[model samples]
Target: NAGVTQTPKFRVLKTGQSMTLLCAQDMNHEYMYWYRQDPGMGLRLIHYSVGEGTTAKGEVPDGYNVSRLKKQNFLLGLESAAPSQTSVYFCASSYSWPPGDREGTEAFFGQGTRLTVV
Candidate 1:
């Protein structure tokens, strides 16, 4: 099964242009997330969905929007792309955590979507 796949592995965009990055998973997981990783800094959450039909903002939700229409897919949209948004984007999924000890959930990552803005 395709655990997780991201489209347009690499992209180039000009300022003010818009694009949408697609993410798909076949694990039937209940949690999905979109994050961006820049040099030096660790992964910063952009958006996440706990389950199908629900989406929420994360630490770095500015300039981005996400949707979880189906259980296996999550989409990240960038409107009016800017150079500051250039970074490696990753989509991840995980199984629901257990009640008390919920700190061990490991995120399964997609290869990554690299975008460059000029």
Candidate 2:
């Protein structure tokens, strides 16, 4: 329990609804990311933050927003839910980027949040 943790393991959301996914890490990592997993596509980054109070858009940021208000927490928000947004969300944290030559610096992932939009 000293790694990444995501809230609400499963949820069913109606179209046009809104929700926020919470990701918290206790490892004091400098980089945190939010990713979604689809059937055909693998994990796609939604948003990421390099440090506290700083965030950047990732591959699929159209229907998502992110905030890193604290060093240990990263939040992903959906303004309006859609069927296309339904996917398994994963939160991760890493001690370094690229992880080059770093044996123990690989990103740590949560169990994932399964969301269904109908």
Candidate 3:
């Protein structure tokens, strides 16, 4: 099974265009998150889903939207592409880590999708 898969490993969009990046995970993690990475900065959460049919905005949810239609799929959409929005996007899934287990707190992340808007 593909643990976590992201579609269109790379993409380039002209400013004002729109596109969706898909994230699929085989593991049934209770929570799923989308994040974007810029040079020198760490991953910043964009949106997240607690379960199928539920979605919420995150730290950087401003130019983007997300939907979790199924337990295994999370979709991130860019309504209108902008140069400021260009970054490496990542999808990650995680189970609730037990309070005392350090090793179990780590999350599983997809390879990432590199997006460029100009």
Give the best candidate by lDDT: 2
- Summarize candidate 3's per-residue lDDT along 1-118 as a digit string, tens digits: 6878999899999999999999998877767899999989899999998889999989999999999989899999999999999899999987654322466545789999999998
Question: Any residue pairs clashing in model 3, and if so which?
Answer: none
Between 1 and 3, whose lDDT is larger? 1
Better of 2 and 3 by TM-score: 2
Lowest lDDT sum, 10 consecutive residues, model 1, at 97-106
RMSD after CA superposition, every candidate: 2.5, 1.0, 2.1
Please list the residue runs of candidate 3 whose C-alpha ends up more than 4 Å from where it truly belongs after superposition. Answer: 97-105
Model 2: per-residue Cα lDDT over 7-94, one tens digit each: 9899999999999999999988899999999989999999999999999999999989999999999999999999999899999999
**Whole-model lDDT per candidate:** 0.91, 0.94, 0.89
Candidate 2 ranges beyond 4 A from true positions: none
User: Scored by Cα lDDT, where does model 2 land?
Assistant: 0.94
Ranking by TM-score: 2, 1, 3
* CA shift of 32, model 1, Å: 0.3
Model 1: per-residue lDDT, tens digit, 1-118? 7888999899999999999999998888889999999999999999999999999999999999889999999999999999999999999998775322466355679999999999
Comparing candidate 2 with candidate 3, which one achieves the higher lDDT?
2
